[model samples]
Target: MNAALKQIDAWQTSLAPTLPTLPGNDIDWLAQRRSEALTQFSDIGFPTRKTEAWKYVATHAIAKTTPALSQSTIVDSTQIAQWRLDDCDEIVFVDGLYHEGLSHFTANANIDIKSLAESFEHSPDKIKALLSQDISDANDAFDALNQALLRDGAIVTIADGAVVERPLHLLFVSTNTDNSVTPINNWIFAGKNSQCNIVETYIGADTTNNLTLSRTTINVADNAELTHYRSQRESKQAFHLAELTVKQNRDSRYNAYPIALGSAIARVNVEIILAGKNANCTVNGLYLTKDKQVSDHHIKMYHAVPHCTSDQLFKGVMDDSSRAVFNGLILVDKDAQKTQADLSNRNLLVSKFADINTKPELEIYADDVKCSHGATIGQLNEQSIFYLQSRGVARDQAEHLLTYAFINDVINRIQLDALRKQIAALIIGRLPDSEFIRELV
Candidate 1:
């Protein structure tokens, strides 16, 4: 057999012993879903270069390594203290399994939170309907694999007309360096007229070379509002792939901010559907890559009904030999009149060898709609650096300031004060002369 086939065979053989141990296996419907997902994964394996959505990314390395699923590890509280945010209700997952000891959050009457395993036991029918929904028409191997090896994750539900005062934080940490994979799946439901904020953070041990496959599904009911912040700062030796799927009802609103920094290879896919009239969405993202790391973002915004609106802005700063990709599309259906959509992707290549591939598309079948999409890829402006130098700033420090400003444009849009400050510090720490930059800021 060829190398790809061999890798696929290896994964199938390795996962056989653990299939029965998966959570929710005792439920007939859940077990059948898992079996179907596993069958799909076994048949198709991972995506290749021919896959349009993943054309810019190469998966050969991941296939060759074929990391095994990670086991729960004993993590110290001190190791994760730095990643925690203040005044937020936190849920912790270590090495893909829910870690109750490291997680603590105050309960609110309007909010209901439970682990996936707990949800299966208490609300099997609801979990079944959510998990059974299709993510996409085309077969996605990663999605299949995530469901097939399903473990523990978070399930959050907000009551109608409720307003949450504190943000909800879901933290996932990886401490294993034995070339393992961690799969996580989460669900969030916001009832009518509710408002809340959620933050999802992923971190790994610095020296570990693990893999993480994560998926989060969200539903916003009529007149509800949700702000979602996703921060990915894994180990530089690790691989991270994540997906965010959202459905918005009439008059619902969703705001998203995604920041990517640490990982050898990281990819995030976002899909949003405006299912009812007057739904709105805003997605702003930033990705900073250094060394030989690769970062990618794919977004799909669908306007299914009339009077819906969406706006997308994504920026990337590539240093050293790092690479990045941005693929965004806005689709307006035929009957979706009065739709307003816009998408823009801007990239900065700080190194001569650093590169970016960006594609922004607009497909509007409604002639009365207003939609636009565009992309820009360029380097730091020399004149701007010279202008800063003329003001008594050193050339290197001036460049650093400009780079920080480029990324901060999106970071500043975050409404949560504590989370914004934490994200800024993390971004500043990744720059050259971080301490000096921090002092200047």
Candidate 2:
């Protein structure tokens, strides 16, 4: 405890310099929340493989180094144009800091975007309410740190009953000068009866070893709908960690699709709270790891109100000496009767030395509620392989096609066809320079 406390103190002292230098804005009110978050991070500095949620994942490579911050890299229009999605608005952040000149968005009367540091003066109460609402601060460490030392990030507000037809892209790009850790925080709000879709992408430098810590919280109001996708493609030596928590209101829909393909060590968390009756949620994810990398996904779903429903599916593929982990928990409260929830995890090992671990949990208190959990860990079916090979498919091509089919289920579930294709291409693009991806249908 004392050691953690000291670490918190160090974080407070070390990160003070990075705080946004702007005068009175939302950040002033956010100070207390940040301190509390720092406290939480200190109490849980780095989770080890022994931790129930981290058993199959070891974060030693990430915990051993605290890289110094570098001058953030800026993405110009040419670079931004590379990621243009169909019917989308883009907001770019370089190395956790806002790159105003590099970002472009059409002005909408009802929608607004401002830096956390710059918007402090608009509404102290609203800002304070934003910081600590919807989250239980005791269980998470990195999330707490995000609250404590977070300097700047995007704050998006959608007006009541408004619908954003275009997707909002929150892009975070890293530049390599050294092995510094960059933390990016995102705060989002979907008003009552509003609709929104957002994408958060993390990119790393080509040469320098970079580490990114990202946190995002979304508030879905009554009758609102939110669709979110996060893509992580950090540098080869980079370490990436991110957490997403969604709070749902009555009759609201919150859906998330997270696809991770880069980074040496990656950890992602998804927490969905069904706070209102009749709410619905779906948490879906896909990840692929190669060489000596590691990736993990942890999910928690809570049915606190009656008439709520949740479904979760996570899929992963590991090749070479890489490793992947999936941990999911579903909880149904006693009074939350008529609740329906299910959790499933499917994984594949593409190489003899690759590793995979999966765990799905269910905690139900109501007798009338329905809940179930299942997980599967296996390699490609040999019979299917034999049939394909016999049908004139080469050995490597057959293996690659089967592997693509294994993960294609998750791809097919993505609501956005373009995003699905982008993710598929990313996975195929990294196919070890072999014939594996070329043969996939």
Candidate 3:
């Protein structure tokens, strides 16, 4: 068989059954999407140095070879104890398979939170209505592949008039057994007048050539509000690719905060589609890297209707020989009049060899819309640093404090106080233990 056909065979063979919990959809549906997805995957399989989108941070290091798909394993209690949270209902997934014992879902009238596999069998109609309805994969191969081979993940659907008082935490840990591979496609939907918060985190207790490509789509109905917090702190040697696409209805609002601090090669692609009039959306991200790691974040907001608004701000701090990439694009369709969008990207490089690539683009077709974008890449303000040093602050301490303050601006915008403080400490602690800071302290 040809290489492509061989790949198809490998993927099809990976869908073998064990306990038959996944009452999967027809192969015809899967095959139809898979065929379309394969065409996209073939068009852009593991972007190379030649691809403009990946021109700066190449994936050749992680893509030199392909590893076999790993088998899903059970998460023993000893390992489950290690996963901790505060005042939150936790849903744990071990290697893309939901763990019932480790999960606690309050089946209240407020919301419907269940495993995708379970929903496939129980709520097939709802599943058929919303699955892959908001996420786009025609331009992305990893997303396309995820749609083609999705097996396990969670689906959070918030019903009207229900406000989840407590935050929903979705935790996925990679129990990479035997060095095989796996990825999960997920979705979350919030209904009209509903309010909820989501904290999705990815951490690896065990790492191999583990590569996770995940796609999450969220829909905010009329007059609804959702605050999403995502944190990535996986093993430094792993490869991670994540995409979040949000769709907003009239008078609906969506806010997203993504924090990246791990992986050898990581990419985050987020897009917000304003399909309804007078919708609003905000996108924010903070990435801290050191030790020659590479992190990339790409954001796109499309104003498909009139009287919508979008705001985006992304900040980064890179040290050692590590690199960061930020690309923010705002697109306003021709008919989308009176739209307002603002975007900005800023990066702080702390080392001589650190690299950062920032691009802010705006494509405006509506003449009356208000839109602007700006980007800046610079170091610590010398005057501020000198003043702090003059005030008895040690040189290293001054720089650390200044750097912390620079990043705190973005951190404080997170509306959830507990999660904001938690992520802030994570960002501050990311400052490497340099010889200079050590000696000064």
Which number leads on TM-score?
1
When 1 and 2 are scored with lDDT, the better candidate is 1
Candidate-wise lDDT, in order: 0.88, 0.77, 0.77
Clashing pairs in model 2, backbone N/Cα/C closer than 3 A: 25-120, 25-121, 26-119, 26-120, 34-147, 34-148, 37-144
Candidate structures ordered by lDDT, highest first: 1, 2, 3
TM-score of each: 0.97, 0.90, 0.89
Task: List model 2 lDDT by residue over 398-439, tens digit each.
Answer: 778888888887888877766777777777676643355655
lDDT of 3 by residue, 3-24 (tens): 5445544444443332132346
Clashes of 3: 3
lDDT of 1 by residue, 119-210 (tens): 78888998878766856542678777787888778889999999998899999998989888788988899999999999999998799788
Summing lDDT over every window of 10 consecutive residues in candidate 2, give the lowest-scoring window: 19-28
Task: Return the lDDT, model 2, position 432.
Answer: 47
**Predicted structure 2: clash tally:** 7
